[model samples]
Target chain A: MHYFIELFFSGLTRGAIYALIALGYTMVYGIIGLINFAHGEIYMIGAFTSYIVASVLSLYGYPLFATVIIAGAAAVVWSGAYGYTVERLAYRPLRRAPRLSPLISAIGMSILLQNYVFLAQTSDFISFPKLIPDLPFMDRYADYLGSSDVVILFTTLIVMGILTFIIRYTRIGKAMRATAQDSTMAMLVGINVNRVISATFVIGSGLAAIGGMLIAAHIGQINYYIGFLAGIKAFTAAVLGGIGSIPGAVLGSLVLGLTESFATGYVSSDYEDVFAFTLLVLILIFRPSGLLGKKESQKV
Target chain B: MLKLQNLRAGYGNIIAVDDVSLEVGQGEIVSLIGANGAGKSTVLMTISGVVSCLAGRVLLDDVEIQGLEPDQIVRRGVCQVPEGRHIFPQLTVRENLDMGAFLRRDKKGIRDDIDYVFTLFPILAERRNQDGGTLSGGQQQMLAMSRALMARPSLLLLDEPSMGLAPLMSKQIFKIIKRINADHGTTIFLVEQNANQALHIAHRGYVLENGRIVLAGSGEALLTDPEVQKAYLGI
Candidate 1:
């Protein structure tokens, strides 16, 4: 029973990270209907940006919390840049082309980005120092979950809240929703559809970057290859929740995260990937629209 | 005022609107009427900057706007109520209207305009919270017109505003368009397949066929002209 509570909290924390990254996938897909395979590399870039920032800040005698915040901010900026450039160079030109070409380009971009990072930085899995200050009640709190897990959960909730606020109230948010609903209507109404799409990518990538930083801080280590698997898992979560829904992404991530933890706990870890894909396949078969996704009707 | 000179537009090598030239003066309701594939809608799109013009010039009040982007054209007070009533399916009526004024910063005026639109189309007020996609076809047409009006545009381009509508509903929409013009004095350039209804309220009219302006005259004159009668009125 105690271990169950522990596993539950641990799963929730991991789910938060997945949810954050999955948002990028859902948001980009919502606007442009592209899978944006290179989005994962944005996650990888974010982790490295945070690692470099925090490490340098720590060496310069900055406090742990301060350094972590700065690193997190840097991660957000870098990931936003990554998303913007990818949209302008990789995806925008192919707007009128066949779908397959853009999908292939996205994959090519992923490979290119991963290799670029690998060449620029060392191939080794570098560690991000423990910059988050652990509370004194850490072990006592861990009767159910770790402090970092609590931090992840709280951060996810806050970010999700802010995101909801933005989507529901602000002008930019309205533009994004309009673009998602119908690009032509948005353009006709003077909503810069391209700008909205770019903003969606930026916001999504920024979220993923923030998540990457948090995960790196919690685990204290990361590598370039980390993004590939994490990206797949996040994509799975996005599709599982419904590719266009914000809440769906978070809920799907939690389910995927819990499933991963349990698979490792009760079964061989080797079967984790198989289990996630199996769940996705089942979802596709049983409820093709997704758990929360409302099925859209074709007008003509 | 909007003017087009020798406008040649196409979708690929197969030309849809060819070498068309026409003008819509300020504060007048001008209607473009033709059959399917007659390029009535294509002329509006080229003027609205949705489709590129292969050759010729588009001038809004003598400011050349031939190659401008769609949003820029819209920003210059040219709002297009697209064919098919392309309202954002997932958005609410309020959000759709807000997007019409997306580039504007006048908060109080925007609020007032929203109120006015509600008065113009009370059903939109009732369905303000409903998603635009779920509205009935007639209601969607109303929403699209309302959204275009939200921009307070100088030149409103309406493409097939009566499309997919019952006869009674189409009459009601046209009545509202007349009311909007009378009350606001907003210039209108309307496209429609239903030539009879389109010419009913138009101050002047142009007839497009095979991507060219086959005829142009005052609305009543064109409605009675022997050429327009044979070609468009099917008399």
Candidate 2:
């Protein structure tokens, strides 16, 4: 029972990271019909940004909490700029091109970002400093739950609440919905469609940055390639719930995380991702629109 | 309220609207009739700034609007009820109306206008919270018009409002169009292949054949013109 509780909390914490990243993917895909393949790289950039900020600020004798806070804001702003640049340079020109064109461009952008980071930040894993006050308990949760699991669960809940507020009540939130629903019509009604699209990418990338930073800080390590596995996992979570649905992404992340954790804990660890892939395949074969996505039908 | 001079535009290479010139005075209904390929829709799109002009000018209330983006066009009080009733399908009827007033900042005025739209289309009020996609064809048309009206445009460009409805529904839609024009004192630029119905509701009408205007006259004159009745109106 103690082991079960520990695994459950651990999975949820992991799931929260996936959910954060997945929200960005799902939101961008929902409003603008592009997959935004370089999104993963933006998260990697955020982690690196946090690293640089933390290192610089600590050298100046900044407190750990202040360093993390300042670094998180830098992550959001820089990642948003990264998203805006990608939209302006890569996706804007091909807006009217064939769907495959943008998809291919996204993949190319991903490769370019990875190599760019490699040239700039080096390819090897680096130690992520302990920014959070993690007082590890060897037996506090061993009899009830794991100490790491508690931090993971609590942190995600706070992040989720903040995200939920931003997406629900803000004026920009309404604009995002209008842009996603019918862009042409939205444009006709005096919406700056381009601005909204840029805003979507920025917000999505910013969120993914926070997720990447959290993951790096929690696990104590990050590399230029860290985004690859996290990206795939989060994409799976987005697909699990429904690609365009925000709530769906969150639910999907939890489901994916729990499934992977249980599989790793009880069954063979090697089969964890295999189970996720299998779930995706089965869902696609049976419910291609995803578990929460609505099917669009043409009037013609 | 609106004028177009030598407006030429297209999707890519094919010029859809070729040297099309037309005008709508304040509180008048001007209809453009043509075959499917005669560029009626292209003219409306160009005026709304969705399609760029190769040459010529579009003026709304004496302001040059050509070369502007679509949203800027709407801000100039020129709104379009596009072909296919492109209301946000997933949104509720009320939400669809709210999106129309997206540019407006006055809360009380917005509320008043929504109530006004519901009054104009009572059936929409009854189904305000229902998904826009669920409304019947005629109801959808009314909702689309209401949504456009939420923008409070001086000029409303309607494309093929009677496209997919039954004859009875089409008649009702035309009647609503006439009423909306009369009550709101709005200038209308209507594009349609339904020459007979369109002519019935216009103060003046023009016929386009092969990307150019071939006929122009008062509504009654165009309806009775022997050439128009024979080839275009299908008498």
What is the RMSD, in Å, between candidate 2 and the native fold over all Cα?
2.0
**TM-score of model 2's chain A:** 0.94
- Model 1 TM-score? 0.97
Give the alpha carbon lDDT tens digit for every residue of A15-65 in model 1. Answer: 899999999999988888899899889999999999998888988999777
Local accuracy of candidate 1 as per-residue lDDT tens digits, B35-61: 898988788888877788999899999
Q: After superposition, how far is residue B145 of candidate 1 from its true place, in Å?
A: 1.0
Would you list the C-alpha lDDT of every candidate in the order shown?
0.89, 0.87
- B145-201 in candidate 2: lDDT tens per residue? 999999988899999999999999899889988988998898888998898999999
Error of 1 at B220 (Å): 1.4
List candidate 2 stretches off by more than 4 Å. Answer: A135-139, A142-148
lDDT for A247 in candidate 2 is 88
Error of 2 at B197 (Å): 2.6
Which 10 consecutive positions of candidate 1 chain A have the poorest summed lDDT? A131-140
Q: Assess chain B of each prediction and give its TM-score.
A: 0.97, 0.97
